[model samples]
Target: MKKQLCILLAAFLSAALLCACSGKKPAEPVPAVSAAPDVTSAPDDSGNDPAATDKPSVPVDTSYNPETDADNLYSSANTILIETEDGFYWCSSTSDYLLFYDNWLEEMIPVCSRPECEHFPDNNVCVQNKKCDAYLEAARHPALYNGKIYYIDSNGIPNPNVDGTRLGMRLFRMNPDGTGKEFIKNLFTPGYEDPQWLIFHRGYIYGMSPQTIIEQGEVSGRTSIIAIPIEGDETTFRTIYEIDNQGWGCMRFIGDYCYFWIHYMEGYYYVNWDTGEIIDEQQMGGVALRWNTVTEEIEILYQELLPKDGYFGETAWVERDGTIYVPGGDCLMKIENGERTVVFEFKEEGKHFVAATVSNGIVFARTVPEDFDDPYGKSEFWVCRFDGTTIFKGELPMDWFYESPEFEGLRGKPRYPGFVMTVGDETGLWIEFGAHWRSTGYNEPSADFLVRYDFTEDGGIEYKLYGSYDDIFIEPVD
Candidate 1:
């Protein structure tokens, strides 16, 4: 009987162990670690996190594909509007807010998504209380690349001193929906200014920094091509190429080479900033340079000498296939494979080709009177194929702005149409009319209109009203 009791006790202990094992839950599978670094995880030296602290927690999309990103050809460092995948992202020209246009909804809204959050005044209940996602304190340049929006904020970080001044400019990036805002790097300190021509290409942000150097009672400016890696911290800032005694001019990129112009300031006259005295009076020439992005080598493409009173337009453009186009006095010149060719020469009397640009295999040339002086004077525009076939050659209809029903009250007023952009095959024109005069005795357009023009297949032209500038903003104007 004692042996039987021992056997039953052993059986009961085994059964109890089995029941405990089945009652417990199985462990969850461990998540796989991401290969890309968490750029927002690291804190700065000041022990403060650069990422938005009050931002609502949202899942980040890690499927960024550079190959399918939008090409940022029209947006430049100084441009207010930047094209993105969905629509355009633009900084308010009149405010400190960043706005976005939703193509599907056909509505413009601030980058902030909080329904009850006011964008202004930094109230306790507003989005600006902690930090507004759309607030750009002195927005310098905002660009879109590789599914991210990059921009420079001049007054982003506050100084530790008693005065309420800013420390320096900060580079930042955010998602398309204004979430996951992260600070990339600090560009410069108090004495230095923000760089110009902010462009995000290949995996870096390229810009031109016009730095002023003073040594031994002489003042000189150094224009440098700066490159900063998009995924790097502050230590990755570098000057790829620099030009002494020159200033920054026009810059364009073609493939891996960045084509730009640097003006000569060796003998140019300029007043001293500190003393306000005139310096050298003789003006010099300028040179166009091509910088290789990979090798960081610079090559001079063209050079032109200027007289004391000569005006250098520096109008040049590069195509995607490494073809360069420049407008001379009366002809359009094309350079490819080190071979210079005159694509077209205007033999018309009293007409001079002033500007030339290429878009979607078509060349647009502007011609003006030989004695043209007014900056807003009437000029003729010529649209031609790559083989020099004339598509259309005539002056743009300036009267369309006055005739449009949208500007009913401002009919027959002095209107000026300026080139805005070229989208697909259509060219955009921004019309500015004298609606009111400011307190500074300067006439400014209270309302501006954007119109798009395109030539049809049968040589007919069609004009469409894109939108009004005032319609995109939320604030009311007088």
Candidate 2:
């Protein structure tokens, strides 16, 4: 009778899975023509097996420290990069493999442990060799906390006992050496869309999910902020806040607060999902907000109606010490303890400060023409101390691109240089450089290299290349 009951439960779950998938899109979309089998995993059953609880049984180490900067914490939604004392570990932007960059050596290598592994797919050599221990298929929002690396595998593992059924969007963790990987929990099932902008802090994972709603023959999207404990399952998932309109939401972390910005259309409304209370209703423009991780309270930092030009400007960045830097008309303003002060001002005739980022007692500011036709037009930058002392001011040099040996053969194509200033510190400013492959068409940008501008004591700047993406593009390793 027990065997019959288990079989009946399996059949019922399969039926439910089919019904769920039929009504909504899959949890993570995969290529339809792929030869690889669907990635899925067995649903964790903690009640049946003590070992299946999916929580780490070992005590967490309290000494593990991670960078709390907004740039490092929330680089991108699809990529996972984390810094440690040893080096940087990130999921490969071009493939399903994980890679490590040695800060001292300034070299990148696959995170594989095998001495002679080529880190490539070879079915004949090993079964599904591409899916190695270092492989993170559809990896998102990876974090290093308490000596373990936790991440979500949007492309999940398949259950062997249940055909045509998947566990769907699971959380996992492994050692820094890419060993002892264990499944944590099924975050979301097949019906719900995968979470975005995941953040791990204070023993909980916070994320946002986009919800599609259609009313009166019109379609729109809403965003829901959620939180779940690291040791908990889907049953513990909680919706903290919800917005009534789709918008560009960027989540950043500083100290005990999670800061985010939402640029919505046709105004917006904030709803506290837990209490079913309407929080705020804004008729125009964007809003800056911060949520306290300890108190679970949401606070609005700033909001403004749409400007006549419709440009809402960039989002404000908060420092680790709780200081906020907001971009005013032509100056960068710093707010601390409810006191506002102008840190840097663009005094040029027809230019204004477009964006600014603060890190390690340094402020990097950029200015652009107030009336520019092309969004990618010429822009200048300044590196200054927090006390308003300028260290360097100039436009980034791109002449080295045509002369560098790395772009020797690729120079024949119509390539345009693109640079993104990511972070700055006492050592220098870190910028990521890419090239637009105009020959291929628009939107085809190549990952070129990551460069740093070292600040000399004499106020001179020196360029250093940290890593290059030439191998990934010049020679296809797949």
Identify the leading candidate in terms of lDDT: 2
lDDT of 1 by residue, 39-59 (tens): 312122222232546323322
TM-score of each: 0.62, 0.66
lDDT of each: 0.49, 0.52
Tell me model 1's lDDT, rounded to 2 decimals. 0.49
Question: Clashing pairs in model 1?
Answer: none
Clash count, predicted structure 1: 0
Clashes of 2: 4
